[model samples]
Each structure stands twice: as structure tokens, then as C-alpha cells.
Target: MNRFALNHATTKFWDQREAVEACARIGAGIGLWREPVAAAGLAATAALVRDAGVAVTSLCRGGFFTGGDRAAIEDNRRAIEEAAVLGAPELVLVCGGLPDRDTGIDTARARVAEALAELAPYAGEAGVRLAIEPLHPMFASDRCVVSTLEQAVELAAPFPAETVGVVVDTYHVWWDPRVFDAIASAAGRISSFQVADWVTPLPAGVLTGRGQLGDGCVDFRRFKTAVDAAGYTGPIEVELFNDVLWSRPGPEVFAETVERFARHVA
Candidate 1:
């Protein structure tokens, strides 16, 4: 059977302890998140997951290459350190949007390149791989400027295979016409594969209104087969950020997510 994992942000409504416990009880073996890990106290959360036999698939985010300032760079470097503390295998990088809040897409791309040059080496040394997560083009203004699998691969081209790679999330790049080609090109370099459905017309641009498994247009089985063909045998993590799921009890949401993941992708 295909393994199902949860992104911590999907269960942000719950405290870290509750979310971790719920995932453990429901047979979930992977987790992806950043802030909650800090708040949960790295050692405590690591021990909890360890006790429950859960796997920390990848951390939520570490890159925000815009701002063009020292502070932002330092913050991201700290994030890499935190990933080491928690025994996470990958640090998801949502490279920043336009620089200084006024730059264009070209400037954002340049900034990300510069930041990655500095950060990737450091992260690689710590035994942590950096997974560059391309945000949807809808987020090109305030979130990640790297908005496609091809773009992400290009950005990671200069780095060693172990130092940089891409996180292929369905919600972000499913609509791209070149998705199949990108996925094929991404063989052996896909650091993570996140699952989420893209719903239409979101009011707020950031915190997802992502659809549930089988509720939206993403063809998970097809994606799984492609990734498997690419030799990426990692966990296919379910990463939703829906208001409706957030309002429910943590355990209920976790169990439902696991069941739906099996029904749709298995």
C-alpha cells in the first residue's frame, strides 16, 4: 500500500502535541511543517514522534529569498539549523517572491538564486536536503516566484544533486501545461511530492482553500506512477489547508485524510 503522510499546516488549528498524537494514532508515518516544530520545542516533538514511530518527511519551509536583506537570510539559515535538530530529511524551500516588496519577477528569481548559493551549501553539510517548493503563479507576487517544476529545476541546476531539488505539490503546479515534461525531467531529483487539490477562486491568496483528495481535479494515481517511474520512492504526503478540515477534531481529520488518500491514490 502507498504510505500517507500529513502536512502540519493542514492541522495548524490543533496544537502540535494534538496533531502529532492524532497522526500517530491514525497510522500516519510522515510530517511536514516549520513553525509548529519550533513551538512544540524540537526535542519534545522529536521525542514524541519517535515514541509514536512517526517519520518527519520534510520540514514546511526554510527559503524566502526576497527582502534582499540580511535579516531574511539569517532567518532562513536558522531554519536549516532547526531542521537538523528535528532529524528531518528535507527543508522545504518556498523561495521568496519579488524583492523588497517592489521588485519584479525577474528580480525575485535573481534573489532566489543568490540566496540558494549561500544557503544550499550550509544545508547540505548538515545532512539536510533542501526541497524547493514552487508556489502557484497566483502566489508569484507575495509567495514563491519559482512557480513551475521547470523553473524549480532550472534554479536547482547549479547545485549538487544532494544540495537542492524540488517539491512537486499538485495544488501548485497541476494546471501547468508542461507538468508532465517537468515531472519527467525531475527524475532522480524530486526531493518531495506533496498532494493537494486546487480549488477555484480563493479569497485569501495564502493560507490554502485546498480541496480534499478525490474532491478536486488532481489525478493522484497518475502522479504517483510518474514519480515512481522517476525513481522517487519517498512518501506521497497529503498536504491540505482547508478551513472546513481545520474546524474538526484533529484525530477525525487525520483519519479521514488517511482513508481518502488510500481511496484516491492507492
Candidate 2:
């Protein structure tokens, strides 16, 4: 079997506790979200993971510091603590978009760097690495300004390699021609590898349009090989945000993801 994982967002309506239990049954790891973890109560969820013997591959998110807001930073701090308690080694960072008043992508990206410099040490102390995830350029204005792997790696450069790293999420990056080169150069700084496909005729607003594996144009096998060659020896997380997938049962989605990984990614 492949080193596959189900990022909780892929099965948005699934009960977090049941997801953990299902992962345990199949010896697959899981990527969790802070909201669910908090809703279930951190201590209780931590105990659930421990009892189930399911690995917490990585935490969903812990970044949004583009606006230099103290609240965002503080929220990330708590996310780090939660990851540590749950035995997750890294907290994925979805650096936020431009502030309503701001218009420059450069300035927004700089804010991300400043935030990382300030938080990296704290994360190191808390035993969690920050994984900077760059979203597609289409989301530059309202979701994330960091639009490529190169940019994400650059933002992570100043910090200690272990304390700050980049997440190579294929869905946001498959269109980049130099993607493999960037992946090769990331080397040890690659903290996470997530996979999802891109389909055309995007859903309204496009946020939840991610395609299931093998159902779109993404070259999953190619991405898998590139990350492996880049020395990423971690779980390959499936994180589709498709509404169609969410309409089905979580167990069914999980099984489909596994089969798709075997056929298209392994």
C-alpha cells in the first residue's frame, strides 16, 4: 500500500473521532483540522488519537499572518500547542491574503516572512514545525498571496530548516512548469506532501472545486516520484475540497481515496 493519508477536509462532514478510528483500522495516518479538534475538546481528541494508534500526519492550518494581526498570530500559537499535544510534527500554514486596504502582493508576502521569523522560534520550542503552503495564484487576492513553491520555499529560507518548511500541495501547484525543479531544490525543507487534482468548469466561487485523484489532469504518479526524489519520506495526504465528494459518506470517500492513490499515485 502507498503511504497515503486522508486530510479531514476531503471528507468535510465526517466525524473527527470516527475518522481517527477508521484510520486506525487501516493503519493510515490522518491530517486534522483545528476547528474539529477544538470542538471535540483538545484533551479528549488527543486521548482518542493515542487510544486508536492513528498517526496525526499534520495539522490543517496555523497561519494567516499576512495582515500582521496579533489575533492571527495568537491563534497560530494555540494551533502549535494543539499539534504538539496530538503528536503532530508539523502545523500546515495557509498564509492569508491581502488585507482589505492592501494592494501589493509583495507587501503581503513580506508580512508572511515577518510572521514566520517571529513564530518559527516559538514553534521550535513547542516541538512543531511550520509548513508554509502556497495556494494557486487565483487565490492571491482573498485567500493566499504566496502563489508558488519557489515563493513558499523562499519565505521559509531564513528560519531553521526544521522549524519552518514548505508544503508541496499538488492541487495548487500542478500548473507550474518549473514545479519539479522547485520540488528537487526543497530537499529537507519539504515538511509535507499533499495531493489533489484540478478539474475545469470550477464550482461557483471555485474554492471547493478540487477534483478527486485520477479524475482530473494532475499527474499524480509524476508528483509522487518528484517528492520521493526530493527526499520527502512522509505521508502523501489527499486533501480534496470537492463538494461532490463531501456529499457521500466519509467512509466511502476514504476508501475511494485509497483506491485512487493505489492506482494513480503509488
Candidate 3:
């Protein structure tokens, strides 16, 4: 189905070209990362995807605005430009957690809002939406201070729906009891929808432990229904950070991801 997409991180070692080609063959969208894209040369990457007729669903990340400094804002601007070049409408933002030696989480989140205010207009002019992705609460201290969909929605409220949006990632928000309500409120601003399962007994590095669909506890169909009901009809990207999947051949992992998506999500 062309409605499905594969986020490049799920097959970490796969070269970006190969991954894009595979998704192209099936008419699937792709979620690309800034590093690999930069490594491959921006013009080349942009042409490759364009020639292949593949849609770039969204950019992996572009935020770490705890400082609200010029550097962070400039970098995020670059990311928005990159997404625009690749014809990606959404540039996902993983707002940074507490800055080093800084213990105030509230302040970190406030900086995110301030940073968005500075960058939203630039993003809108570039034809890209800044999608605020709220990570699970466990990441509140180090990775993302916006740890709930509600908070993300609130952060995005100030800007136009086209300029600022919120991402719905199952691995990050499935545990919250009010996720459905948040999704409903995100009616005009649901930028991207990502699917990943949650398995218990996290590995030593929990970041890489997101399970394959159907291999964990997430209710994929339920989320799908909720998102659809909320009026989101865009590509559903499968993003898994599992180490086991990354260790396999990219083609193999991609095939498995497609199959699982068919069974659990599609």
C-alpha cells in the first residue's frame, strides 16, 4: 500500500540510497534523517528521491532548543530547508531535554515554545511544518522535555496549523491514558503518525528497544482507528529503533516491516 512508509532509522545501517530505492519500488513513503542526507549530499539525495517518485514523509529531527540560542534556531532553519528541498511537508522536532548543568525541565520546555515562535514563520515560508514529537516520560530528563501529546499540542497552539503540528508516535504516547483526547484535539495539526510497539524489560539502552509491530503490547489497530477518526489521512510511517532489526540486512528488515505493517497496522 502506498499509504505506508518506512522510517530509515528502523534499518540503521542501510545506505540511504538503497532504502529509498526499495520504498520506491512499492510506492511507499520514506522518513529520512538529517545525518545520512547530509552525508549523501543534499542535492544528490533530493534528486534521487525526486527521480524515484518517492515521498519523503518527514525529517527525523530538527530540535534541541533548550538553549533557545541563535545556533539551535539556525540549525532548525536548515533542517526545514532540507525538508522543503526533499518535498517533505513535516520536519519532526524532538525538543531537547534539560541543558547540561540545568535542572529546570519547565524552563527547557519554555525555551522550546520560544524557539518555535522564532522559527515557525521561516518554516511556513519554506512550505514545511514543524512537528513537535513528544517522547515518553522516561526521556523527559535527557532527550525530550515535552513528554506528552497534550504538551506538544499546547506548544503548537500558537502557530498556524500548517506551520506547527504534533506527531503521533505510538512508542512515545501509547502509555498515556489521555492520548485519544490529545489526538482528537490535534485535529488540524497532526503532522505525522508513526507506529512502533513497546516491549517490556527494556534493554540496557532503552532507546533501541522499540519492538517490531505485533511483537509487543501496542494496539496498532486501535491507534489507526483513532488517527483516522481524528481526520488524519497521511502516510503512516513505521519507525522502530530495535537493535535486532538493525543488525539484519536492510532488504530483509524492510520486507519484514512491510509484512508486519500489513498485519498489525494496514
Candidate 4:
């Protein structure tokens, strides 16, 4: 399906050029990561994707605004520019978690709002949407403060939909009882839809434990139906972060991911 996409993180060890070529061969869109793009050089990466005729659906991340790090803002601006160069429409933002001292979730969330207010206009100028991604609560203390789709929508409300929006990742929001309602409320503000099943016995880092499509408990059909009902007709990016998958051959992993997506999500 044209709507099925592969997020680069799914094959973390794959060479970026090979990944692009693979997507081209399969006629699938690709979601890219900044590290590999940087390793390949921005202009070169852009040329490779353009030559391969693979649509760049979205960029991995751009936000980490909770600590009041000035460099973070500048880095996000650069990421926006990179997304534009790659023809990606959205730049995913994982708004950072609490600072080291004195602040709690409320303060962290407030800072995210402030950061969005500052970055939204810049993203609009770059023709890239700042997509606020709500990581799971387990990551709220160290990785992200935006922990729910509802919070993401509220944080994005003040900004124009063209400039700021939210990311709907099944792995992060499946546990939220209000997720369906949040998806409906997101409506036109949904900038990206990422899929990754959730598995237990999380690893030491808990960063690469995402399950393959049917191997976990997420209800993919329901999420797909809900997002469609919310008027989101965008690419469905499969973004599993699994160490086991990364240990396999890239082509094998990619093929298996596509088959699983067809069976469980598409």
C-alpha cells in the first residue's frame, strides 16, 4: 500500500542509502533519522532520496525544550531546515522531560508550551510542521514531558495547524484510556501516525524494546480506523525500536516489517 511507510529507526543498523533504495524498490515512503542523515551529509542524503524517488514522510525528531537549553532551539531550527531539504513535511518533536532541579511535570510542560510558541513560527517559515510526540509515561522523567495525546493536542492548540501538530504513536498512547477521544480531538492537528507494538519485560534502557506488529498487544486496526475517522489520510509509518530486529539483516527486517504491517496494520 502506498500509505505504508518505514521509519528508519526500524532498521537502526541499516545504511541510510540502502534504506532509501529499499523504500524505492518497494514503492514505500520513508521516515528518516537525523544521525544517519548527518553521517551521510545533508545535501548528499537529499540527493540520494531525490534520486531514488522515495517520499520522505517525516523526520525523526527536533525538540527537547524543557531545560531552557538555547542550543536546543537552534538545533530544532536546523532540523526543520533539514526536513525541508529532504522534502519531509513534518519534524517530530519529543519535548524533553523535567530539568535536574526544582521543577516538576507542570513546570516542564509549561516550558514545552513556551518553546512551541517560539519555534512554531520558525517551522511555519520553513514549511515544516513541528509535530509534538508524546512518549510513554515511563519516559516522562528522563526523555519526554509530553506523555499523552491529549497533552500534545493542548500544547499544540495555540499554534496554527500548519505550523504545529501532534504525533499519534500507538506504542506510546495505547495504554491511555482516553486515547481514542484524544485522536478524535486531534483531527487536523495530527501531523504523523507512527506504529509500534508494545511488549513487556522492557530492556535496561527501555528504548529499543518495541514489539513487531502482531507480537504485541496493541490494537492496530482500531488505531487505523480511529485515525482515518479523524480525517488523517497520511502515511502510516511503522517505527519499531527493537534491538532484536536491529541485529538481523536489514533487508530481512524490512521485508518482515512490511509483511507484518500488511497483516496487522494495513
lDDT of 3: 0.94
lDDT values, one for every candidate:
0.82, 0.91, 0.94, 0.93
Residues forming the 10-long window of minimal summed lDDT in candidate 4: 97-106
Deviating ranges (above 4 Å) for candidate 3:
none
lDDT of 3 at 184: 95
Writing each residue's lDDT as its tens digit, candidate 1 over 126-187 gives 88888899889988877788999999999888998788989989989888899888988888
**Per-residue alpha-carbon lDDT of candidate 3 for residues 1-266, written as tens digits (9 for 90 to 100):** 56899999999899999999999999999999999999999899999999999999999889999976789999998999999998899999999988877558878888999999999999999999999999999888788999999999999998999999999999999999999999999998999999999998899858999999999999989998999998999999999999889989999999999999999998
Q: Return whichever of 1 and 2 wins on lDDT.
A: 2
Q: Residue-wise lDDT of candidate 4 within 1-266, one digit each (tens)?
A: 67999999999899989989999998999999999999999999999989999999999888889998899888988999999999999999989978787888898899899989988888899899999999999999898989999999999999998899999999999999999999999999999999999999999989999999999899999999999999999999999899899999999999999999999998
Using all chains and alpha carbons, the TM-scores for the candidates as numbered come to 0.94, 0.98, 0.98, 0.98
Q: Which residue pairs of candidate 4 clash? A: none
C-alpha RMSD by candidate, in order: 1.6, 0.9, 0.8, 0.8
Clashes of each: 1, 0, 0, 0
Report the C-alpha displacement of residue 41, candidate 1, in angstroms: 1.0
lDDT, model 4: 0.93
Ranking by lDDT: 3, 4, 2, 1
Q: How much does candidate 3 score in TM-score?
A: 0.98
